[model samples]
Target: MKVGTKEAAELLRICTQRVRQLLKEGRIKGAEKGDRFWEIPLFDGKPEVKEGRRGPKPNWKKRVSKAISRICVNQHLIRSNSKHGTNKPVIRVESRGIIRYFHSLEINGSCKVVYRPDKPLSCGAKLWLEVASDVMLTAFVYS
Candidate 1:
């Protein structure tokens, strides 16, 4: 006997839209589309969904646009693999608590650290950083 999509969806334990999609994909044999409804054969039983990828594809390829400057916070020196220049304006700053960079701002005190600012800090180039920090920081820089 031929049944409508609603009845076929109920017998297949799926939604009516899924049944319609199966009919459109020609997975449900002997199913014909009428003016606005689908006529599915009752003997076709439940069709098995093809086992394949489910979600969106991942992004595996990485493109680097900026030259990375590695900084050893413990050593207080910056290193770069790019041969463009030895004194590039890019500096990799890593702080345990907070890290802040200013163009012409210098902080000096009797504490254990003193910062002296230089002119012409960065050119028209942009800076991009990727950082990983944990909760409950205690103000300590790691190499």
Candidate 2:
């Protein structure tokens, strides 16, 4: 029996989206277009997935990143240093139908709170960044 693209992807040990790409490129054998979907013929072995740039690759060796964030109602260019244990930004990707961006300030090992009249540590607000989509930055958020 023929299967849909999603089922074919499962049998092939690949993603459904990639299966669709393969279908578009005419790479899948015994693949036919149905009224509602593409009917793919399932075989005994795994199908060959296309080789291309699936996504962006980030450089992990570099750690120092710069970001413009609003702290205490003022915008300052924040330079994040991974060497520092405290005040490092942590990004979390939520597992769901759509990818979610969640950011928080983290302090590891030791933390010290200093009170100053001119500048505060908490900043009395959440961190907001201003940067381009192509740029990558690890912001040091102060909470």
Candidate 3:
């Protein structure tokens, strides 16, 4: 079965002008039969809607590798002494690992330190490291 421009529009629940626009954009496969007529071929005995283009897929392996590299290089160990608190020191790290781009660090134990990065990191950026205590260690990394 086939459908004219108007019929196709009605069947597709779109306006007649939209049908013409789709034809102009080469979205829907159809051909002009005359000055004001068009023929849309049927697929599986029915008119089929055109599919849209999809964006590129993400590179998971590259992201994982970059995260591992950041961790292995000890990029999260950078820090400075706190000016306001004489006993406590401020810690910082480039974003990376399970925490990509920007992330908050929470260390539980002796120091009980909480650290937030100065800037957000990229999809596979390095992370800053901060420690709160000297006993057992618990770290939380979020993407």
| Candidate that would win on TM-score | 2
Ranking by TM-score: 2, 3, 1
Model 2: residue 138 alpha-carbon error in angstroms: 52
Q: For model 3, how does the per-residue alpha-carbon lDDT over 61-110 read when each residue is reduced to its tens digit?
A: 12211111122122333322233333222222332223322234443333
Report every candidate's CA lDDT.
0.42, 0.45, 0.43
Off by over 4 Å in 1: 44-143
Sort every candidate by lDDT, greatest first. 2, 3, 1
Q: Please give the distance, in angstroms, between residue 28's alpha carbon in candidate 3 and its true position after superposition.
A: 1.3
lDDT of 2 by residue, 90-131 (tens): 442211122222244332222223335554334333433333
Candidate maximizing lDDT: 2
Q: Least lDDT summed over 10 consecutive residues: which range in candidate 3? A: 64-73
Candidate 3 steric clashes: 17
Candidate 3 local distance difference test against the native: 0.43
